[model samples]
Target: MSAHTNPPAPFAGVNATWIYTLGSIVAVYVLLDLLIITDLLSSFADTRSRGMLALVLVSVAAAATRIRYCWFLRSDSGSGLPHIGWTIALFAPAVISWGIAFVIPEGSFFAAVQLWFSGVLFALVASRRLRWWLILLALVLTLIPILVSGMAGDRVELGERHPATVLITIYSLVLPIMLISSLWFWRVVARLDEARSLAAELAVTQERLRFAADLHDIQGHHLQVIALKAELVERTLATKPEYAAEQAGEIRLIAKEAMEETRSLVSGLRDVALRDELENASEVLTLSGAACTLEISSLPAGTDAQRVLAFVVREATTNILRHSNATEASIALAPARGGFELTVKNNGVGEEPGRDGGSGIAGLRARLADVGGTLTADAGRPGAAGHRSFALTAWVPEGGPQ
Candidate 1:
C-alpha cells in the first residue's frame, strides 16, 4: 500500500499525543522509583539499595533525553546521518546504566529488568539507521556486560548453580525481546514519516502534471482552429475579396478569444473565486478532521478583491491543515472601513517544533503588499474559556491597485 493510505500506526510520529504519553510513563516510573527508594514499596535490602536508586534515576533521565532526541530527529528532513550529538546523547544513558547494572551488589531481577530496558532504548534509537547488521552489532554490545557479570561469578559452582547462569538466562531472553520490540517500533515510525513526506511530494507532482496536461489541451485546441481558419481565408482571398475579408474578421475574433481564454486559464489557476475557494477550503478542512464554518455573506464572481482574498483563503487553509491540530476553523469575509476584510481563524496555534515562522504566511503577506493590500497574522483574542486561536486577516480595497 502507498504510504499515504497506510493506516495510522501507534507511536508513528513524535506528535503531541506521543510526547504527553511518554512524559506520563516517565512520571509513573519516577513515582515508582521514589517509592522503592524510600522503602515504601518493599523492605528488601536489595530493593532499596542506593545503587539501584542511582541506576533508576539515571535510566529515567536517559530514556527521557533519548526520546526527546528521537522526537527532534523526526522533524528533520531525514537526509544524511543523524547528528553525532544525538547518537551520543542517546547512547550515553544506555552505556551508563549498563555499568551501574554490572556493579550492583549482586545480580537481581530488578537489575536484569533495568539492563533489558536500557538495551531496548538503545535499539529504538539505533533503529533509525535501519540497518540489520548495525542492530546486530548493538545487540552484541548490549550482551557484553551481561556476559561480564556472568563470568565474574565465583568458580566454585558450575552448571546450574552458577550465579552467572540466572543472569545469563534472564538476559538471553530480555535482550532479544527488547531488541526486537524496539526495532519494530522505530521501523514503523520511520516508515510512517517517510510515507507522509512522500505523499505530500506526490500531491505536488500530480498537480503539476495536471496543470501541464490542461495547458497542452487548451493550446492545442486553439492552434488547430487557427490553422484551419487560416487555410479557409487563403482559399477565399483569390476568388472573393469580400469573402476573404469576412474570413479575416472571423480569424481575428477567434484569435482574440483564444488569447483571452489562455490568459483566463492561467490566471484562474492561481486566483479562483472566493466562494469556490471557500467551498474547497471547507471540504479540505472537514476531511482533515476540523469542523469548518464559513461566513461570507456574498462573494462576487469575478472581482479583483475576490481573487486576492481567494488566494488568502487557500493559503490559510493549507497552513491550518499542515501546521495545526485544530479541531475547529472559521473563515469570514465582510465589508470593512472603506474596503473588504477577509479573515481565517482556527484554534491550536503554537510554534511548530524545529520550524521558524513558515514561509506560507510570509509569502502571502508579500503577495498582498504587491496589490496594495495588508495582511495580519497574530494570536487572536482569547475566548471566554481562555482558548488560544491564530488568525490571518487581510484587507483589499474595492478594486485592486490600478
Candidate 2:
C-alpha cells in the first residue's frame, strides 16, 4: 500500500455523504432554474395577475428547497469528510439557493436581498467553512443598494437596479455567476477527495483479508494432519513398544516442522507455491488409497506454482477423500483456448460439490474469482459408463485476469 493512502476518518465519511446529497440538490436547482428562465413556467401565467402569482410560487418552491435540504443534512453518521471539502458540501445547498433566487424577478427587493444572506449563513453553519464576517461581507456590500435607495427615494429600489440597467452591467450579472461557479468547483473537489478516501479503506481491508486467508490455508490442514497422526501413534504405542517408538519419533519431527511453519506463517511473509499445494494434495490423496495421476504441462513463470495449483488440487483431493470412495483420482493442467485449465476427476459416486462449507469448493470458487479465474464442478462420466464421476475444473485467462 502507498504511504499516501489513508482511510476515511469518521468525520470525513460523514462529510462525503453530505456533499453527495447536497450537491445533487444544487445540481437540480440549477437545472430547474435554467429551465424556468427559458419561459417554461410562463405557460402557467395566463394573465398579468397569474404571472405575478406564478413567480411567487416559483420563488417559494426554491426557498422551500433550502429548508428541505437542511433537514437532509441532519444525518448523524460518524464519518467526517475532509474539513475543507465538507465545508463546501455544507455551503452547496445555500449557494444553489442563491443562484435560483438571484435569477428570478422578485416581487419585493427585501426578499431578493435577504435570500442570499440566508443561504450563505446556513452554509457557514453546516460547514463551518468561512468566518461569519467574510461571508457577511458579500451581504453587506450588496445591501448598499437598499441603503442608497432608502435614503434617496421612496420604495424606488424595491426591485430596481441603481442605474436602470445596472443589473445588466459588469457587476450583478458577471460577478454573481462567477461566484456561483466557484462554489460548484469546490463541491467537485470535495467529491473527488471523498472517493479517494473510500478507495484507500477498501484496499486496506482487502490486504488484511488476503493475509488472513494465507495463514488459514497454510496451518489449518497441517494441524489437522498432525492431530490425526498423533492419535494413530498413541493407539499403536499401546500395542507394541518398539513400533510405537518409531511412530512417535516420526510424529515428533513432523510436529516440530509444523510448529516452525506456524511461526513463519503468522509473520505474513509466507506464500504457498502452486506446486507445493499440488504435492501436498497428492500426499493426502495417496495416503487415502486412491490411485492418483497429475498431468501438468505449463507453469506461469516466477509465481508460486504451488499456490496457484493448490486451489484445484485441494478441493479435488478433498472431494475424492470425503464424497467419493473412488479408486482413482486424476488431476490435469493444460492449455485451453483462452488461458489454461486445471481439472480433477474421480470415478466414484460424487456428493454435491458445494453442499457444505466443509467441502471447501465454494471457497475455492471465490478464491479463483479474486484472480479473475473460475472454478466449476460437474457430475458426469469418469471416462467410463455406469460409474459415477465428479469433476472440478478451473480456467484462468491468458492475460492473468479476466
Candidate 3:
C-alpha cells in the first residue's frame, strides 16, 4: 500500500451531494452485478443482452457524473468535485464493459472485458497510492463468476437459467476493495503534511534564541554602571558634603534617564527607528559625560512607516544607555535588497545581564516577525570589539505591513 490516496471527506465537509450520490449508485451497480452472476436474481433480469444494456447504462451515467464533477472542481462555486471524480473512476469500467457486451457474446469475450475493467480499477487505486492488494483480490474474485458462469452457461437453457456476464462479476468483486483502499490512503497523506508543517515551526524557534541572547548583554552593562554610580554618590553625600552633593545630583540625573530608557524597551509601542535610537543614545551618553555620533540613510515611506521605525529607534537607544558605557554610538537606516534595514552600533561593555533583551524586547521582535519582519544583533566584527551593533530588517509587502 503506498499511502497518499484519500477516501475523501464526509458530505458535510465537502458540502456536496453529487459525489456521494454517485458513490451510492456505484455501490448498487456492483452489488447488482454480483447477485445477477450468482443466479440469485435470474428472474430479475437477463444475464446476456440485458446485462450488457445495464452495464452500458451504468457507464454512461458514471461518465456524465464524472464530467459534471470535473466541472464542479474547476468552478469556484464549491468543493467535493474531486471526490466525485474518485467515484466516477470506480464506475468507469462499467461503461466500457457495456460497450464490450454489445460487441461480444456472454463467453470468453465478455470475460476478457471484465478482466480489463478490473485492471483499470487497479491502476487508479494504485496511482493514488491506495492499497493495491484489495483491488487485486477483487479482480481475482471476479474471475470466479466469469469462470463458473462460462462452464455453467452451456449446461443451462435460456428458457430456465439466466446468464452471468463477466463485467458484472468484476464490478462486484472490485468495488469494495477500491472504496476501502481510497479511505485508508486519505488518512496517510494528511498526517504527512501535518508533520512537515510542525518541523518548519521548530526550525524557526532556534533563530529566535540567538537573537534574544545578544540583545540582553548589550543592554545590561549600561544599566548596571549607572546604578552603581548612583549608589556610591548617595553614600558619599554625608562626608565631603559639597563634592558629594554634586556627585549625588549627577547620579540622580543619570538614574532618571536610565529609568526612562527602560520604560521604552518595555512598552509595546510600534516605533522602530534606527536613527532616533542612536540620537537618544548619544544624548544620554552626553548627559552622562560621554560623546555621541549619528548617521542615517534614506528610508522608504509608506503607511505608518515613520511610526513603526520610531519604536525601533526608541528600543535600540534604551538598550545602548542601559548596557554600553562607550562615549559614542552610530545609527543608520538604509535600503537593502528589496526593503529597508536599520542598524545601531555602540562601543558598550561586551556583555551584561539586563542588556540581554527581556520579554519586552522579545515583544518588539514579535511585532516585526508577525508582519514577516526580522531583528538581529551582532557584537561588531574585528576592530569593532568592545562595541555592540544591532541590525533590524523587514520586507514590507507590495503595500506595507499590516
Candidate 4:
C-alpha cells in the first residue's frame, strides 16, 4: 500500500467513515462549547468573565487540535511521534486553558470539567510512549483549578463543606476512566495500523506465490520436453548427425515455446479467450459427466474486459471439475446495467470450497477488482427438486476501471 492509502473505517472497516466521524465530532463539540460556556457565564456573572472565556475558547481549540491530529494519525502512514511543531500546537491550548481555568474565580466546576475534557483530548492525541506523561499531566491539571480555588478562598460548597473535596473525589475517579478509555481508543488505532501493514505484506506474498505457480504451470511440461529432446540429440550426435540436428532444432523450438509462455504469464495475458473458454468449459464439463449449456452473447474480441471475463470463465470451469459432482452446468453471459455479467452455475456443490471460496476464486476476485469488476460465489438457493447448487458470478464495467 502507498502512503496515500487510507486505513479502513471506524471498526466497520469502511473507508469513508472518517469523513462522517470527523464532521460529527466537530458539530457535537461546537454545540457543547456553546451550551457549557453560556451556562458558565450566566451562573458566574460576577466572576472573571475574561479568563472564563479564554479558558472556554482555549479548551475548544485544544479539542479541535486533538481531533485533527488524531484523525490524521489514524492511518498507518501517520503513525509515529508527531513533529515538534504539532506537539506544541496540540498541547499549548490545553496548557493555556489550564492556566486560565485556575485563575477564573468561583468558576471551579466549569473550569475543572473543561480541564478534564481537554486533558483527555491531549492524552488521546499523544503517542503511546508519551501518553503516560500526558495523562498524568491532565490529571494534575484537573487538580490545579481546585488548588487555585482553595488558595484564593473562593472554593464553592454543595453543603456545609467545600465542594472542592467532592470535586477532587469526582475527578480522581473520573480522570482514570477517561485516560483508560482514551488509551483503548489509541490501542485500537494502533492495531488498525498494524492490520493495514499486514494486509499489504500478505498481498505481496500472495502475488509472489501466484507468480511461482504460474511459472511452473507455463514452463514445467515444456522443460521436460526440451530435456528429452536434448538427450536424444546427444545420443545421436555422432551416429546420425542429421537426426541429431533435427532433434537439436526440436529442443530449440520447445525452449522458444517455454519462453513465450513465460512472457505471457509475466504479462498477465494467458492464452484464454471468451469463445475458447466457452468451448473448453463445455468439453471439461462433458468429460466430468456433466451436461453443459452455454448462453454467450456477441461481443468484440480481444478487448481487455473480454480477456478478464474469459479468465474468470476458465477458473470457474476448473473449480467445477475439481471440486463438484455436478450433473448439470450452465454458463451465461449477457448485458446488464451499464456493463456485462457472467454467471457460472453447477449442481451438486457438496461443500463450500475453502475459507475464501478457493484460491482460484480468490485470485479471480483480486484480478477482477483491478478492472472494476467483482466475483461472487455462493452455495446457491435450493432448486425446484430440492437440489442445491453453486454459482460463480462476475461483473465488469462497460469500459473497465481506469
Leading candidate by lDDT: 4
lDDT of 3 by residue, 42-134 (tens): 332554455555554554444344334332222222222246446556456544553443333343334333534434443433443443654
Measured with C-alpha atoms, the lDDT of residue 189 in candidate 3 is 46
All predictions: root-mean-square deviation over Cα? 22.4, 13.3, 12.6, 14.4
Best to worst by lDDT, what's the order?
Answer: 4, 1, 2, 3
Comparing 1 with 3 on TM-score, the higher-scoring candidate is 3
Better of 2 and 3 by TM-score: 2
Ranking by TM-score: 2, 4, 3, 1
lDDT of 1 by residue, 1-402 (tens): 655676566644544445554454345434433432333123234467677666666656665664465444233222454577776776676667767656762433233344444444444444455544554665666566656655777223323333344444454455444444543454566578779899999999977764664454345434544565577678778898897787678668767866775687777643345786787677657645679888886554336677667767766776676567778998888888667888888886655322324565665566677677888877766565555688888987666664
Residue-wise C-alpha lDDT for candidate 4, range 1-402, written one tens digit per residue: 556866555545433344444555445445545555565555446455576667667766776775566554343322655567876787677667666655665556455655565555555555557766776776776787767776777654421232234544554456546445544555566578679889999999988987875564345445544555677678889999999998788678768877887888889876645786677567657645789998888553437778778777767776675567789999988877678899999997775456568766787788789788888887866666666798899988887784
Clash count list over all predictions:
0, 18, 29, 0
The lDDT per prediction is 0.59, 0.55, 0.50, 0.66
Model 1 residue 23 lDDT score: 56
Q: Global lDDT for candidate 2?
A: 0.55
Task: Provide TM-scores for the models.
Answer: 0.38, 0.53, 0.42, 0.44
Worst 10 residues of 3 by lDDT: 72-81
Please list the residue runs of candidate 2 whose C-alpha ends up more than 4 Å from where it truly belongs after superposition: 1-180, 239-268, 291-306, 318-327, 333-340, 347-350, 355-359, 366-373, 381-388, 396-402
Local accuracy of candidate 2 as per-residue lDDT tens digits, 1-402: 657866766545546655655565455445434443333234335335544454545454554554444443343222332355444554444344344333333322322443453344244334344534445665664455445545555345343422323332233334334434544555566677769889999999988876665555555656555654566667777788787687577668767866776687677555556766666666666555678887778855424333555755755665566566777777888878677788887777644444433536666677777667887777774344455777788877666665
